[model samples]
Target: MKRPSVSDSLKRLMAPHSIAVVGASRDPAKIGHAFIRNPLENGYKGRLYPVNPGGGEICGIPCAPSIADIKGKIDLTVLVVPAERSIPALRQCAEKGVEAVIGITSGFAEAGRAGAGFQRELGEILAAAPFRMIGPNSEGIVVPKSKLQLTFSPMFNAMVDGPVRIMSQSGGMSGMIASRLAKRGVGIGALFSTGNEDDINTADLMEYFADDPGTGVVLAYLEEIRDARRFVKAARRYRNGRAVVVMKGGRSPAGGRAAMSHTGAIAGDDRVVDGVFRELDVVRIRDSHAAVDATAALSMMKWMRGRRVGIVGIAGGFGVEMTDLVETSGLLAPPFSDKVQKKLRPIMPFYGAVGNPIDMTGTIINQPDMFRDVLNIAIDSGEVDAIVILLTFVGEPKIIEAVIHANEASDLPVLVCWTGGGEDTSPACQMLYGKGIPTFDSPAAILTGLEALKAQAGL
Candidate 1:
């Protein structure tokens, strides 16, 4: 009897029932300490073991001198020990039937010479075992909904779980994007950093995430992909309706060299990466910022079927700018029908223009419902597939609530581009984000994100 490739691997890799933190430490400042501290901080409800040679206690839990000393079936082990100690530690975990291990130490192939040799030995140990490994230089994993923040970053402790699951080769990128998305009140289902991938690589995780019940969007930031054919197969298998996004780094010669040194992996040809991503229908993004935006939009507005959009903004200048943006991004701002315009004519300001970019005019400042009224009209018109709401100032709770209500009533996706609102906008923007509306700071980003969403649907 054999463990099914997918289930046996990911159960321990992701939703582990019990774990042992192999270099679990005393000092909270140390990465070693994070393995124990982070999980508790995130409210992990599973059994946790701390392993140290001079075992006493870590965070008040009884410590084990080694994995063999631990008294139960260990599902996972987090190796935060040095490179020299990692081989023995990994061997012990595997012998003890530990299903998965995530090594967070940095001194492996990326460190050169002696470290490379150590990495090779570690690889051989992995190949001989029934266990799976993530990295010797990884940052661990975080599954927000499971209360599993297995990584070392305190910034992710308060993060909420959503449909976007991020898997990156760089731990810093995973944290940065997760924090950014979390700050906007967007939920993150899971995040993993696969550094110096010797055993479990991005493709394995991609296949897992593609079928993950919690994930609606999968974002990967790759310096290099270990297996291209496997990646394409995974993409095709899981791409039913979910968006699989990739941001391939190290496109330039110098950058490729840097990536080699950084991950101890070759940065494969960027052109081939692009072609494969296109052929597999994967959304290839350029930066983490855009990646975060794309993830949020795709995860939340997956129902959006068309590229037609309606613009609602306070300033005529912004409206004009957005008009240009729609044209450039290949998105359409369909004209409102005559009957819809007649209905809107009563609520709109006498002087305000109402075309595709429905400039509600500055009169919306005092009469905020006028803005809400326009939003209702645009949504009701059915002329647009999505609505772009740009605000110069976001005050008036009633109008916000009204717009939110209107947005809830319509199937049309409503996106916000808010700028210059200063302090008052933060809470309001957060409200929209919490409701799954993707918000950006500028006209270009809003339209650009809309276009990306449209592109995701192959429009």
Candidate 2:
């Protein structure tokens, strides 16, 4: 496989011979301050060059008043300057023969015409220059291998290292998801936010991640596709190395209206986008939780072993809803064969929804050991490839034990859906999450995660 475009550029940015922060600052509140602080605070192992007209030494690094003050070829320049100042900074970077520029500035196309004009000008500058640009209005990019946290978002500095690479059109969403995933113990290998995507779009980044050795899954959140053809082609090529899971906004007209007004995105036919997603084999998320949950599952679990899945939940109604999701999401829930049914019949005394859904009734709530026994039977029967364990309320300690045991016993990936609300079982949920089982409060999100896993594994 060919190397991704972003990886080499990323290596330069993360561990450049010298890096200049164009809008380097002393004030802690400013975006520039955060950008400079990340590398320093997180112990980024690279040469740091701070740039500011008034600079002497900001953040204890030797400051350069301008890009020219650098002694040799500067590998990367991070633009934390204002929207109007980006062009001059790009000109300086081009003059300095910098390999890449991370535009952490906003107020580009996302801010409308004047901002759009500024973004266009920056693009023209890059076109005439020899360097690559990550964004004109991006949060910035991160390459874990180089320990580079180029974004101004404070969260990136605290990121956990993992095999997934993330790209988003919304910087805030990207930061938010990355933060939450880190909290859940899933680190990202690289992260990019192509704000407005005037030049370095998601497709280009996806292509780069496709060949990146560290990346196993690519998680994306888009309001629109700037380059559809490149995205499809890249996704197809990356199918094995990196699975692309997307969460696109603008489904309803209300949502579409909001997306357009928010990011100047042209919200076209969502169904058409869906079809394109299908063609590219990209998994589209329905909600925020699904994005993180699907990322965890896809990054950790194998593809679906079979189309048929046994969804056993302590809650009867939640199991029923999961069954509905399975059918609608195109996964088959074939009825259990008589031989398998006989094995279950002797164990399950109460008449639950004993079809493919395999509702354990409230039996597991009382007899937690039964949960493991039932799961082992379900997985062993060769009737289902995956299991969805739904618990309404984890009031019993046995249930938790059973879940842990079941997870250990089964090779098939198990997704847990814990229904009900409030703080009663947050501990239990966290416990399950710690064990590498994706846990969710919403059955819909859990099912969505499973559906995405099935789609990616090509079951």
Candidate 3:
């Protein structure tokens, strides 16, 4: 058999109508047990069969002795058995005509020479078989839209369906990014943790997500690009429609060694990788925090018209700081034109600075309408491509409402930096988030979001 394409394999793997847990366990501490329990708890509307030699029930579902015993077709099979037993179990799945397999069993390539040899045997089976495999050392996959939680990671409990789709080499990194986004009131449509990349790699997943209508943005965490040509092609195709934000690991020599031990990855030249990302217009982030922030911004705001930004705030000092930060972040903070400043003057206090960073001063605290007026004027003035509003301890519903209304009124991207309110700001922040406006606590974080917007805009 010629085997299936990456897209075809991923379709079955991601949205399988029937799945079998090859090593389903009765013990809760085992990965097999968690895999079954997770999908059931997460509401996987599929035919789930647990394959265990013990021939018992797992979480109320009857277990088959093996894939051969399963009467019906298996769309996907997850192997959680030990390395020694993985090959035989995979062969059973192949015999059963399973469409895809997730090799959740670790101790493959990352486990040293013995593991490498074992992985090669698995690959040899897959090369001649009709089915496709994900990993011999993979964390599994998640499709929130279908409520498919194939991984044993407990992080899927917090998973929600949204526009951002994540593809990471490390399973832990995928969970971390997803958790961080969820905390920021953002959700992901799908997650692919390509551990070891023995069979399916990041490039394959990238091509799949590129055409997925539900995915508005793609976030990736990589240690190395095994096939740079295929990766560049997929990234180019993906970037044509949605933003691709990546965080590359193993940039340093020491980090490269760590990556090698972690996933058997060989870190290539960082300078060459940086050049490729720049040319492809990929938003490459360094830390997990920035990855989450960038993903949220790109997924929510979509894109900015330009790098020019209108900074509006209630506090003057924070306004000054944001002004400096915005410019330093490679974005423009142009002074408001005379005509625009005229519209802003009546709404501002005498002590307020009404230039680029329009400081409403503390007086706006007493008059919330002034805050609304400033945002409207900034949004309508057309002086800047986007707006970043700074607020502190001002949790008034009207303020949040004004932002929501302005965001809806204009095509320009609007971001909020709400800080110092403690628990009081939760409702207001939640409101902004609900409206799809990116909200942050610190000025620096807000700028990080804008930088993502800038990258997506190709500015």
Candidate 4:
């Protein structure tokens, strides 16, 4: 058997066996203390060595003065020291043969002119170095699989595991998006907050995740990319297998200024960015939540080459919106042929129609099996290539199971849109979501998700 070829330095950077935090602090309020608390609290099982010149103890672990004092193999160094000490610290890490350094200290390029100059100097010192660095203003990384939680964010404590790999220029943005997905019961494979792009840029990680078997989708939040050509090439490479969702910030002038202040990288022209994304065949998203939705849909369902959509639900309104969406998006709601309709007519309720939008009305609450019967009949009838089931209310959990079971038998993809009854239907919706069915709470959202999935088909 052969192993997937990953950059040796990147492997150490993300999945290091041993690590040293250069500025471990005793105070709980300090960022340095977070490095200790996050990894320790999250059950990281690697050898941890904290380095502080004071030679004090933090979280019951003794500190080393520097990398020079640390013995054994050191895979990575998390430098949380002050800006004045960050450059020299990188030099020391390089000397110690550290494979990577995560610069968590701020006051770099985003701070202003002098800080930008200092950051340039820091990058110069790392030229052709043995180890790669993540950020000078980064929040660090979290590898849930390896139990390597280097972030200080509290949200990571409850992080879930899944297929999306995150790349962000802003650490807060990365954590917030991944946390949102996690809160929705979605899993995140790895998250890299590549602040300032001092050494390891966004392009490098994208290329790495392209070959990574654990990653099924790539979600990126970018204010600025240092190397457009490299990032595009990486996107091209990753596109051969998985889905890439990019949410580019800084389109307006004010937003551009804010983006520069936020990450110290210039936002390129928005039109040019759009063209690049279009050419690469990647989905360009407008917001974080939509990015999550798209990733969820892509990760769960099989590619739907045929767009003949079928709507099944108790709510007639769901059928209306689904029909409208299909009309607008060039999707089809091809009515069941007379032969198939005649075959299913006796089983379907007399009051509701069995056209493309087979609304069963609220009577489905009484006969839950009727829902599955409708689904199985529709799938077997060969009238539609895809299904949009409106799981409006939870009359019985068995109906939900019926939907799942019915969909499992067909090659056609199924999307469940649970609407109305407000909070009453949430449990069922989440159940479907947990079962890997791109479940949405409303008709509009589900239709939008379907359109996104359709847009990315055969890419």
Task: Using lDDT, rank the candidates from best to worst.
Answer: 3, 1, 4, 2
- 1-459, model 2: which lDDT tens digit per residue? 122255566556556666778988888888878777887777676677888888677788867888988886788888888988878888888777788888878887778786878867876786677677777778888766677777787877667667788999888898888876765556688888877776578987888767667777899888877677888888898665357898988553334443536234654577667777777768888677668878877766456766777888766778778888888878877888888888877777477656777888875666666676776788788778887777777646567777777777777767767665411236776666556554666777677777887777665
Q: What CA RMSD would candidate 1 show?
A: 4.6
Taken over the whole model, the C-alpha lDDT of each candidate is 0.78, 0.74, 0.82, 0.77
Q: What is the TM-score of candidate 4?
A: 0.88
For candidate 1, the clash count comes to 2
lDDT of candidate 4?
0.77
Model 2 lDDT vs. the true structure?
Answer: 0.74
Q: In terms of lDDT, which candidate is stronger, 1 or 2?
A: 1
**Runs in model 4 with CA error above 4 Å?**
1-6, 251-268, 381-385, 420-430
**Which candidate, 2 or 3, has the higher lDDT?**
3
Q: lDDT (0-100) at residue 61 of candidate 2?
A: 80
lDDT of 4 by residue, 1-459 (tens): 121233767888778889999988888999999998899999988889989999989999998998899988899899999998877888888778888889898888889886877778786777757777888799999888888889878866666667888888889888877776665556787888888887788888988888788887788888886677888888887554467788888753333443536334544477667777877867788777677667666665355667788888788887888788787877888888888678668877898878888888888888887777888888887767678888766537889889778767777767777564322326676666566664666776666667666656632
Better candidate by lDDT, 1 or 3: 3
Taking all chains together, each candidate's TM-score versus the true structure is 0.90, 0.83, 0.92, 0.88
Stretches of model 2 off by over 4 angstroms after superposition:
1-7, 14-18, 107-112, 240-242, 250-268, 345-356, 359-368, 392-411, 420-435, 457-459
TM-score of 2: 0.83
* Cα lDDT of model 1 by residue, 372-458, tens digit: 778888888778888888776664677667667877898776777777531123667766766766567677667656766776666
